[model samples]
Target chain A: MENLLDKKQSIIESALELVHANGFHGCPVSQVAKNAGVAAGTIYTYFENKEDLIVGIYDYVAEKITSYIAERDDDSLEFENRFFNYWRNFTEFYEQHPAIHGFYDQFLNSPFNSEKVQNRPNMWHEWAHMFFQSGMDEGAIRATNPVILSILVNTNITSTVRIKKNFKTKLAKTNVNLDEISQLIWAGIKTA
Target chain B: MENLLDKKQSIIESALELVHANGFHGCPVSQVAKNAGVAAGTIYTYFENKEDLIVGIYDYVAEKITSYIAERDDDSLEFENRFFNYWRNFTEFYEQHPAIHGFYDQFLNSPFNSEKVQNRPNMWHEWAHMFFQSGMDEGAIRATNPVILSILVNTNITSTVRIKKNFKTKLAKTNVNLDEISQLIWAGIKTA
Candidate 1:
């Protein structure tokens, strides 16, 4: 059982690397197997197919990202502090593991993103919604749909990370202060 | 000369319609010609190939969107009103012509997005930047990098339009006030 799990884990890691480097169509199951150092058939033993492999990678990356943020989260803190921690953790994870973000970008654009993919309830999102609800209750966040507020705040974080990644030199040259960004986003969503 | 321009315009319009419906790969030159009611060779006369056609479509859409916003723009207006007008124009354009937005979405994800495409030196962007600079100079906007502020505002517009298009039911269900969304975004970037 341990050996089976190891093989599955290796296959997933290999998929993430290959899919990140090359897109979904670029990294076929054959390439994933070769990179994983297992027989091409071995990939099938783990994932049903290439699409399945990609889905598995998505789940893995999502969990890694959410768990990292969750660990940094402290329920006892003020909503603002907790949100900052979440944002910081998310940005740091993307900064350190760009491959995960790369795969995620590709996955979002890929054909695999169906209703099933879109509506797949996520624990992280639930946690975020709960946090936003509490903020709304406390009259700290906008009374507008909590979902929209969360999306706006989330976009700020993602946008910051994207600029930091894609325009590293330009971002550095501009001397953008990351800390100020979260505050700006908060200003946008907080109640008047 | 007039006839040639009309044929070319028809081909370009047909390409946009088909490509937006079926994606770049799904709509070949032959199909565009068929939709345009022109000869297959006629498409070649106007565009060198499929990629060129897609580029032409993008340029056409960009001009349409920018011109629409520019026509409504008044330099005499306050920056806040001007920015709101820009936001409303952009969203209305996308909402009315979702196929254009669809094609744009696919084009962005396609391999055709080269540095040349990325740095096309859009006049619309220059106008936006100048407006942002003025806002910053006048102390109406946040002192943060104007680019970041512009991106945040632009993302809010795009995000709203996307949700409005893709989740019309949910959007209506939630009674999301589109006007309020721009205000929320502006709140993020506006100074005291």
Candidate 2:
């Protein structure tokens, strides 16, 4: 059973790397299987089809991110400290796994992310909602819609990561301090 | 000359629709030519190759967005009103042209957005910088990196649009007020 799980995990990782390099249509199931060092039939054993494999990649990334953040999360910490911790953990996860960003950038816009797919329960979004809701409950954050707050904060992190990755040299030359993004978001959402 | 320009525009429009519907790998130059009602050879007259056509789409969308916002911009208004106006105009543009959102989501992540490609000057970014800088000049907004501000503001608009489009029914059911996003951003960036 453990060996079977490992093979499934390996397939997910391989598919992510290939899809990141080449868009969905470019990375067919055969290519994914070759890259995973598994028989094409093995892929079907794990996923229903190519579309299933793509959705599996999203689930894999989402779980990885949520687990990383959840491990670092200290509910006992002050709300502001917790906020920054979440920000740092989220950014570091993407920086370490740059392919995840690429995958999301393509996946979210692709046809695979249909209404049915998006409406499916997502772990990462649920984690974000609970985090923001806790802050509001404690009167540390503004008493606005948690969904909106999550969107505002999460988008900032993802966009920052995207820009930093895309314009590494250009950003280094300029005084574009990324920390200010967190500070601004904190200021905007914190209870005045 | 005008007729020739119209042909070029039609080709671009058709390609955008095709690319949005089908990812870059799925949309071939031949299909684009057919959709545009032009000869396959005619696409070459305006664009050098598939790669050139993809870049042309980016340029086309950028120009359309910047021009739309620019035409609605009223510099004479107070900075805050100008800020909201920019936000409203930007959101409305995407809402009207949902395909632009789809194109960006794919293009920005695809191999097409190479460093050499991204390094190309973009009118939209420049306009955003100037707009934010003007706010700082008037002592209305915080004195932070304009690039960061642009990322934060623009990402919020795009994300909100994406969510609204993707989760139309869910958003309507929840208290996910979209306007709160702009207000929160303003609260975060405006001078205390």
Candidate 3:
């Protein structure tokens, strides 16, 4: 059973590669199976269909990221410090695995946008929301709606990922530091 | 030449219909042409290829939206009133066109994010930046970085669009009125 789960996950990650490279509509399942070093039947065994495969990748990654963040002792640190570390770790992790960025944006714009995929108990949404609310209560972060604040932070990080992955290094040449991107957000939302 | 331009635009509009209906990559030039009531060869005369056709539609739609906001007279109104009118008008305009929304999110998320979009002197960007700066000057909005404020507005507007279109009516059931969303954003930036 464990081996079957591993094989299924491997196939899904491989599908992410093809999906991001070509596009949601451009990639084929046969190639995804080939890339995963699995058979097409194995792909079907894991996912009911291509749509399920696409959203499954998102859920899988979201769960992993949230779990990682939740395990951290962020409460020991200052609010900004905790958020900074989380943002750095989150962005770096996704940057290393560019395919995840592809799926994240894809899920947002896809029909899955309409699908309510058990997001509440999910580590990503719930934990992040609490973290921001904690910051707000501690007077470290602005008293703006923490939910909206969290949303802003997520958009900044992910949109930067989207922008950086999409364009050439033109912004870098113009001294557009990516770190400042977060700091700018942090500054705007800070209670100083 | 005038007749050709009208026919070409109609073809592109038809392409938008097909692309929106069947995701971008799912639709082909031949299908677009057939839907447009034009010959496949005629499409090639107007567009270089599928990517080009997609790009053309985006440029057309983006420019139209920007121009609508641009042609408005907000100069005489007070800042708050002006901002509200612009926000209301922008949302109304955006809500009217699902194709534009589809094309936009797909375009933003795709590797086509930059595409040297000839950015239409986006009044919205300029307005927000100025709003931040002027508010700080007048001792109204906070002393934070205007750039981040711009991002907050973006997060608010885009997420609102994302939810409004994607999330069905459940979002409103929670009591996050558009007016309150606007106020939450305004309060975040406003001076105490």
Per DockQ, the best of the predicted structures is 2
Please give, as one word, the docking class of candidate 2: acceptable
Predictions in order: chain A TM-score: 0.88, 0.93, 0.86
Q: Tally clashing residue pairs in candidate 1.
A: 0
Candidate 1 residue lDDT tens string, B1-192: 269878888888888888666555467777888888898987878788776888888888777877887788887888888888888888888889887777765555445655577687876667677778888787787676667666666766766776666667655565346577677667766776
* Per-model TM values vs. the true structure: 0.83, 0.86, 0.71
Error of 1 at A66 (Å): 1.8
| Model 2: fraction of native contacts | 0.50
Query: What tens digits encode model 3's per-residue C-alpha lDDT throughout A65-115?
Result: 787666763698888899888888778777888887777767666555444
Model 2 residue A4 lDDT?
91
Task: Name the candidate, 1 or 2, with the larger TM-score value.
Answer: 2
Worst-scoring 10-residue span by lDDT in model 2 chain B:
B169-178
**How well does each candidate reproduce the native contacts, as fnat?**
0.21, 0.50, 0.16
lDDT at B108, model 2: 69
**Clash pairs for candidate 2:** none
True contacts kept of 1: 0.21
